[model samples]
Target: MQLNQRINAFVELGKLLKDLAENETIAQTILAKAEAENGWFTRENILFSLNNWAEALTQANLLQWMSKYNVELLPQESNEVKKVAIIMAGNIPLVGFHDFLSVLMTGNKVITKLSSNDKTLLPFIAAQLIEIEPRFKDYVAFTEGKLEHFDMVIATGSNNTARYFEYYFGKYPNIIRKNRNSVAILNGTETEAELKLLADDIFVYFGLGCRNVSKLYVPEGYNFEAFFKAMYHWKEIIHNHKYINNYDYNKAVYLMDSFPLLDNEFMLLKEDKGFSSPISVVFFEKYDSEESLKKEVSKHSENIQCIVSKIGIDNEIRFGETQFPKLWDYADGVDTVAFLLDS
Candidate 1:
């Protein structure tokens, strides 16, 4: 198919996913399965995750290929298609979904090894995709096997796990995921509405995903009051999740032992020298120049995923997204589109 045709196919797949969201019966069924099978993931979490994936894989994300690659797709020469192996991450909801879309949209077969933490959602979505368009089944496979058979690989995991992926999959062309996180830039200009949504960006998912904002680059003397006020309603939210609850439990003991924190009901604001990227914990820094901030951020660029603020002449940005990563935002900076096309 032509590149435009492939792009249209991706658009169709995105709509199919959105359709899945509005279909209440299927939604409930999938949510139940996702909860039962995913263990600890709630129904609302599953639905929200599915919806996020549906939104990200839109034409806007796919069009990124046109500009990024600077090439158009060629018509298929034969029915034979490449087979790509995807090693998915379970960090956030449906983290592997992007690879699935990359493989399917590129008219390639996907031999997927689902993350043990997220085994349920991908398989369920694959089954649904077959039902929505049976022909897609021929182009996909969910499996666990030796990596030699696949033409290329896209793997997501920790920096340590990435080293292992490199050792094993290095024989072939591959995309290996390493540790990464997102940061938020607050210039003290955000309105109430923006702060509210931005807080959701930081706290939602318990700051677990790579896209979760784990650090804030704020202007000097920026009032924490505005941020705290916008997030006041979520005060009761801190101790709700098991993971966050454990964090708070430990933090309380640490504080009793003389660990310092800027007190607030929803989250603890502590002065820090670094970023954790996947916790309610966030490191804060005040910057005078965009050059200096980007210089500081550049040192940890490999560890940062998205920047959730506007960019300026002195500012720089990377990773293509803030909290919501579309089909093109390959996890851990792996370029699945390039790998797929080359394979």
Candidate 2:
């Protein structure tokens, strides 16, 4: 298919997912199809996150961006079509979807190895596309095998798993999706609504993804009330999940036994000396000037994604837009499509 033609199909594909989200009947049917097909998604946060991804893509202006960006990124020579083996990260909802969009936008065939934890969503999405237009099956492929014989590869995983990816996939020309974390910069000028949105960014997907706001850099006189109030909704979520409940319980015990943190009732605050975000942490620090913040952020450039906050800063993507990535928002900040097509 021609570039714009394929893009138009995907735009409709995105609209289908969006309508599924807004309409109870379609969304529930797809969810049921997914459950009948993939076993694990019947679980909690995984299910919530999967459903949320469909809502996010169309709701977040990504579909609109795709319609624009896909044709713009089309390869000059059709023979140079790059076939990419995509290893998705299941930690967050549809984490690998952006990379999928990138490959497809560049007129490449994607052979995706879905995260075992996320098998349900990707397959169902593929099924929907095929149902819309079977030709998408020609553009995308699924493989349970470890990626083999591809022009390039993209893999996302934990910090330690990233090392393994580098060792295995890096030998070939590839972009290794490493253990990255996003932090928020709060200037304390945020209004109540902004704080609430920022809280959604932090708590969504249970803060498992690279873009999740695992840390925050705050101004000296920051008011914590705004954040707590916005995030209060997730309290029931925290209690209902056994793993998060364990984390909260153990975190409280550790603080009591070992030491204390600059924290309150809703969330704990701590500082780490390095880049990777703690599994369930919300670090806070006082920033005096933009120069110092820039220096610190530059130091961790390899580990950061879109900074989520209302602060007037560079690279900030605003609260509640953390996972709402668009065509050019490449993972690890590497433009894979540009690398392939330009080369």
Instruction: Please write out the lDDT profile of model 2 over residues 1-343, one tens digit for every residue.
Output: 6655666666677677656655646567657755555443444544455445555445235545544334555666767677888888876546677788777767788899998767767777778877877876777899997677688888878778889888887666777766777888887677777877887777766677777788888776777777777777666554535436645775777677874565545466666555454544677667788778878887778878778755466777877788666555677778766665554
Q: Estimate each model's TM-score.
A: 0.85, 0.83
Q: Write the per-residue lDDT of candidate 1 for residues 158-231, one digit (tens) a residue.
A: 87998999998898878887877778777887788777877777776666777777788887777899988876
Cα-based lDDT for every prediction = 0.70, 0.69
Off by over 4 Å in 1: 1-13, 56-80, 145-148, 311-321, 329-334
lDDT of 2: 0.69
Shift of residue 135 alpha carbon in model 2, Å: 2.0
